[model samples]
Target chain A: MSHSVDTWIMALLTLCVFSFLYRDNPFYRFAEHLFVGAAAGYLLAVQYQNVLVPNMIRPLGRGNLLPLVPLALGIMLLGRLAEKTSSASRWALAFYVGIYSGIAVPAYMQAQIFAQLADATKPWQPGWGAINSALILIGFLTVLAYFFFSAPHRGLHGASARVGIWFLMVAFGASFGYTVMARVSLLIARVQFLLRDWLGVLPGA
Target chain B: MDEALDVRWFDPNRINLLVGLSLFILFLFVNLRRARRAPSGLYIRTLPALQALDEAIGRATEMGRPVLYLPGLGDMSEVGTLAAVTISSRVARRVADMGCGLLVPCYDPVVAVLIDSATREAYTQAGRLDSYRSGTVQYVAAAQFAYVAAVTGLMLRERPAANVYMGSWYAESLFLAETGNETGAIQIAGCDQVTQLPFFVCSCDYTLLGEELYAASAYLGREPVQLATITAQDWAKILAAIVVVAAVVATFFGYTDIDKLLKTS
Candidate 1:
């Protein structure tokens, strides 16, 4: 009876969410509000358990001064809660933004810029790969040219940017196809859940 | 075996680093030199999606509905989030100017605070401080799907006429855009995440592709340094293309020298 009740609840919630397809209704609002409240509550609980207890409460209780640093920053961050103390939050925001920017610059340069350049540069390997390799090189160069907004995209530059658009369109198209498949898979999963878990009309677990 | 991966003060074997660093320094130098000169000559090619910002806002004004801005789920650590913040400031300015409602729902409290200040400042600067509502910029939820659900619910309840999504988005990208679409709102979306680009393209009336997000932010900010960086990055990209061409040529002829120079971990 308990299992059947749980199944009914699950089915009802699912239907509440799916009703969004028709139009936004009271049921959807309930589901959405429930989700937001639950998420916020969960995050608070997790932070208290994983972060506060482990890092702050326990360490500070044991007379360690280190946890005070993050605690101070956290308090400053919460200053945004009040309009008067809001300016104090900038100190923490700046600290975060500066550290992140400093780290991200070199990281992006190495990971995104340099690594991509290396892959694009190595066009020739062996066998029938030559054609694909050339296409990649051309596509890459053209795309790079397209992004150069400082230059006047006239004559040769215009032509390359145009080609770049075609390459980009093809890439976006392929991505869309992949994402559609992913979407369909999500649909399939939900259908399976409905059939097996909710209705018990499918095979046993 | 791991000797090749030894940490060094500076590894001479990694020529890619040298080249990248050189290019970066050179870009800085060029931008510095250019900054000393007239700003009038600095030109960026037109991006249609960026231009649609005003149009979308106008649509909302006409419909007597609010403009909803989703700064995505990215925290401040990501440049994408900063870019989104920059864009939000610009949108807030426009909305303030128009005396129209603008709602920014944030997944991060820190960002929510930052966004609130930006929006408030924009209103103040526009001499419309009275119109600035603190509740307009709100912290919704930290969790991904939760944020999505809350934003989608807001879209439904308010029936915002223009929905703007910017920054780093994930699976929630399509759901947000599609919800806005269903609401008959004119949606404009931009993200650095390539995977989410296609979804935005499908559901959004205008979508900024890749670094256009950065470029748009810079364009909107109108900060000389940011503008300089964008142009400098362009020069670096051009130089990168040249290097790629040379490297490919050398590789075609079975020369390992160029290959060695370009190899990175």
Candidate 2:
């Protein structure tokens, strides 16, 4: 076993989290609560030091009037604490939503829609690559048809949509398999830490 | 002067995007006016997950168990989070009308505030403001895994009958869904995150894939303007498909001008 106190604490906490797989128990609960509390507290501290201090407080302190706008919005967000002032919070929410939507609308259009369409339209390579390109175009068109909510799915549109559903399901299946592999890797890492770091029993250790 | 140093006020490369956006807004305005004039003519296909919202709340009410809602891991700036909150408002209104308990644990503090306000407003609209509990919405941990752990713990302890998850999700999607599944709750999950949809589809009773989550607000609200926006989006997609096919045909004929025009930088 490791002689270091920190290492022992880390191992025990790791085991406590792992204990959740068996069932919820006191050890797991203790670790969970500790993690939650520490995370929240750490987040508050970090936000205060890194975000509020640098972005808001320091700017305002330096006589920059620009930070006042966000400060006012932040204060308005706090209006939810009371019944009478709660409606004022909507303004802050509206401002936030408007800003984000304005920023995202053009970005999404450029990146997702136009850029993707441009790439898809590029000339196909020779031989087998042309077939692959054709398949991609078909998939893109079918999926687009499937997502066409304005039109009723009937006849040719319905057939294309059915093909689109198959494409979506196959994509989802591949993604699921890939993610499951990632999760298994995470588990292996935890096991490796237990054996190699804590007990010093692994080959490298 | 060098061409590189000739900085203009606007980027010519993004003209296509500007034109596209302008066309979309024109469609939106035209549709909105039309829908306002004749609201009854609009048709929207049924979304199974949205249709189940009432059933989920009813089940929770019948079982005398609270309904748990997680508004995702995103803050207010995310469109997914905004849509989730809008749907949550409708859910809250229904839960209030049915006299069932509602619990919303939030990842972002700002989102928690917004949800809390929205829920209260929903209660007011339902004429059940007296039944509204201040503790219905809460700020959980800001950290992702910590928030998941807390929610899973709540799921086990409360054993809520219905779990509604919406908004932008990450790895915690499976953790939350699987835990709710274990508790035998009827779970409804919706997210725009492509990678996380598979996990939700596997675990949840109903999953809203991609744009369905965005469309939930319009579907639930049934407002002319919102529905008009959906129609406008469909028109934009149709236009995009046409452009794609035309560009492909043009490139195949050795005419690369269309492809170059569409390129953004």
For every prediction, compared with the true complex, DockQ reads 0.68, 0.67
| Top candidate when judged by DockQ against the true structure | 1
Q: How well does candidate 1 match the true structure, expressed as C-alpha RMSD?
A: 2.9
Q: For candidate 2, what is the DockQ? A: 0.67
Task: Please identify model 2 stretches exceeding 4 Å from their true place.
Answer: B1-9
The superposed Cα distance between candidate 1 and the true structure at residue A85, in angstroms, equals: 2.2
The sequence of per-residue lDDT tens digits that candidate 1 reaches over residues B165-226 is 99989889999999899989988998899888989999999998888889997777666677
- Could you tell me every candidate's TM-score relative to the true structure? 0.93, 0.95
Proportion of native contacts kept per candidate: 0.70, 0.62
Q: Could you give candidate 2's per-residue lDDT for residues B60-163 as a string of tens digits?
A: 99999999999999876677898998899989989999999999999998788878888988999999999998789999899999998899989988999999
How far is B155's C-alpha from truth in model 2 (Å)? 0.9
Candidates in order have lDDT scores of 0.85, 0.88
Clashing pairs for model 2 are: none
